[model samples]
Target: MRFSRSRRAFLRAGVAGGAFLSLPASIYRTALGADVPPSEKVRLGFIGLGGQGTGNMNAFLKHSHATVAAVCDVDSSHLAKAAGVVEKATKKAPQAEKDFRKLLDTKDVDAVVVSTPDHWHALTTVAACAAGKDVYCEKPLTLVIGEGQAMVAAARKHGRIVQTGSQQRSDARFRQACELARNGALGKVHTVKVGLPGPNFKAPGVPDSTPPAELDYEFWLGPAPARPYNEKRVHYLFRFFWDYSGGQQTNFGAHHLDIAQWGLGMDESGPVSIEATAQFNKEKWFETPEVAKITYTYANGVKILCSLGKGGYPGGTTFEGDKGSIFVDRSKITATPPEILKSTGGDVKLYVSNNHHGNWLDCIKTRKLPICDVAIGHRSATVCHLGNIAVRTGRKIAWDPAKEQIVGDAEAAKMTTKEYRAPWKLA
Candidate 1:
C-alpha cells in the first residue's frame, strides 16, 4: 500500500534528516502528524499488564516521543500497578481499566499496544482495528491459524497500521545473520535448527483453587473453553495449556522459527508438509508436550528442525548450510564460518532501530509496515502451529498456504479456527 504524501515526507525527512524540506505541511498534519503532536508525544494505551505486557509497556515508555495515556488489565491489581508505573515514568496520570474494551473506547489513546495472552490476541486486535486505532500486538500473532488470517484481513480492511512483536526482525545482529544466510554466506542452506525451551510440566497434583478476587477469571478465559481457574493455568503458565496456547511451539518457537524463515526467504510462505513426534506425560498435570522434535520440509527441500532440548542452542536458532553454520540467540551471535566475520561490502536491508518498540513508533508515523507485518508474522507463526498440529494428530499434514487449510483431514482442519465465546467473537 502506498503511504500518504505526509507519511512519505515524514519518513524521508526523519530518516534522511531534512532531506524533504519542500514537503507540504498539510500532508504532514493530516497523515504523519495525526497521532504525534507537535510537542512530540505519541499518546499510547496498553492492554494486558502481565509480565510480558508490563515489560513491553516499559519499553514503549522509554521512547522520548511516547506517553502512556491509559492502561488496561483483566486483573484489577495489575491495572492499578501499571497505571502507577506509567504515572511514575511519564509523570502523567494515565487512566486505568479492568476491561480492555474500555481502553479501546478512549479517544485520547492514539495507538494501542496489546500484550495480552495468546487467546486474547485476535479478539483484542480485531476490536482495536475496528475502533480505528493502530496496533502493536505481541507475537505469535494469533492463537490459531484462521485467527492470523483474520487479523491480516482486519488490518487491511480497516486501513490500520499493525506491527507484530517479533522483535528479532528489528535487531541488527539477527538481521545481519539472516542477510548473510540469505545471500549465500551459508552456501546451499540445507537445514535450519530452531531450538526453544521445553514446555511446562508439574507433578500430578494441585486441585483447582479459588481464583484471586482481584482478577476476573471468567473474563480472562475470554474465547477459551470454560474451565476452572488454577493459578498456574491463568497468567504466564497459560502457555502450557492446549486450549490457551501452543506451548513453546508458539511461545519461543514464534521467535526462532521467524528467524529461520527469514534466513530461508520464506517469510511470506511456509512448509508444504509437516510431520512431528513428541513425548508427553498423560499422567502429569501438563497438557502440552514437554519435549518434542518437529520437522518441516519446504518445497525447496529446505528442512527446519524444531526441538525441545538442553544446551548450546537455547532460545535461539542455528542455520546449517554447505559452507558453514551460525548460532544466534538474544544475547549473542556466533558463526563457524570465518568469512562471515570478515567484512563484506554487500548491500542489505537493515531496519533503522534495534529497539522493537521504537521501530513500531517510527513506522506509525511513516505509515510503512514494520519489520514484522501481519502477513510475515502470520506465515512464520503458521510454521509453529503446523508443527504442533502434526505432533498432536500424529500424521503428516499437507498445507495449502493460499487456502490456509489442511488438505483432507477435516478433524485436523477444524482445529485451525476456534469457536469464540459469546460476545468476544473475532471481527
Candidate 2:
C-alpha cells in the first residue's frame, strides 16, 4: 500500500524540524472547544485491526468525542471485519484501505490509533506524528531501544500528543497501588516482582507455507528482516517470534514493568544494570524463552525482579518493603499488614481515567499529557527490551539512562536500532 501524494505533501511540510504547520487556533477552538463541544467528535483513524486492534477500536467507539473516520490493515479480511464492527457500532461507515499511509492522508482524521504489531509501531507512530496527528500506540513502545528515542523525538518535533497503550497506568486500582508504594506507605520499597504470562509453545515443527493472498506479506514485514509468512508467524502467535515482537516479555512485560516502574517512582528513568537467565526449548518451534528471570538494579539501589511463572501470581507487580508487601493485578489489590491498605496518604493521586480511551480523548481536548505519556512508556519498554538483550547476549549490561544507550558494549549497542528495509528509514 502506497501513500497518496497529498498525504506525502502534508507530512513533508510538518516534518520541518519542530515547526508544525499551524491551523488557526480558532479552528482548533471552534472544532475542539465550544459549549456544545464542537460536535464532541474527534475523527479517528485505526492502523491495525487484528484482535487487539478490534478491541481498541471498540474502546474508542464508546467515546462520544471520537468517531472512526478511517481504518487500515495489512490483511483484507481483518480490515473488512473490523470496518464492519465499527460501522455496526457507530452506524457510520469509515473509509477502509489496506495501506495505512493512505489513512494518514485523510484530513478528517485528527488522531490515529496504532494497533499494529511491535515492529510496525515506531514506523506508524513517527509517520502519524509527522502528519500532524496525535497517536495512541500499543506497548512495548518500540521493537528496539533507539526506536523508542526516535519516537519521542518525532512526537516532540511535530508537537503531537502520543500515548502508549499501557492501559494499566490509567487504571484507578493500579494507579492507587503505585501511589501507595511511591509515597512510602509501603515503607522503604526494596524489591518488586513483575510477573508476566508464559511464552507461546507449539509443536516441535511446522513447515512454512505459501503466504495468504489476503495479507500483504512484504508490507507486514515492514522494517523487520525479510522472512516468509507462516501461520505461526502471523496473528496472535507472532508474539513468539523475535523479528516481529519480543514474545511475552514485551507483550505482557510492557504492562507489568510499567506498573513496577511507576510503583518505584522510576517511570521517567530506569535501572542502570541488568542480568537475565532464560530457559528455551531448543527443539520447539518458538523463538523466545518459555521461562526466564531478569534482575535490574537501579542507580538508587532498588532491585526489580521480573519472571515468568504459572498458577502462583496473576501477572502483576508485587512491591516488597520494610512495612509490608503489596500485590496488585487487574482484578484487585492486596497488601500485607492490612493497615497499609487503609492508610491514605496525600500523594496517592489517582490518574482518574474511567477508561483508557477516554483518558486520551480528554488529554487531546485539554492538550495535557496522557497517563502513559511517550517518555514514560519508552523508559518502561526499555527495561523489557534490555532484559531480552541480556538474555540473548548472556552478559550483564551497563546502561546509560540519560543517553538511552548501552555503555561499553558496541555489539549490544548495535541491537539498539535495526536497519530499516530499503526506502523505509526510521525518520
Q: Candidate 2's residue-wise lDDT over 1-427, tens digit each?
A: 1224553344333221222333324325543333335345678999999999999998888766778899999999999998898889878889999888898988888999999889899999999999989899988888998888888778766877788999987787888788788888878999999888887556655788899889998899888888877887887888888888898889889999989988877765689999999888687688888888889999989899898745334588999999898999999999898778887766545455667787777667666667777767888889999999998898999998766779999998888888888768888
Prediction 1 TM-score vs. true:
0.89
Q: Cα RMSD (Å) per model?
A: 5.0, 6.4
TM-score of each: 0.89, 0.91
Cα lDDT tens digits, model 1, 16-77, are 34221221233223433435663456678999999999999988787766778999998999
Q: What's the lDDT for candidate 2? A: 0.81
Clashes of 1: 0
**Candidate 2 segments whose C-alpha is farther than 4 A from its true place:** 1-27, 30-38, 202-204, 310-314, 348-350
Query: In terms of lDDT, which candidate is strongest?
Result: 2
How does candidate 2 fare on TM-score? 0.91
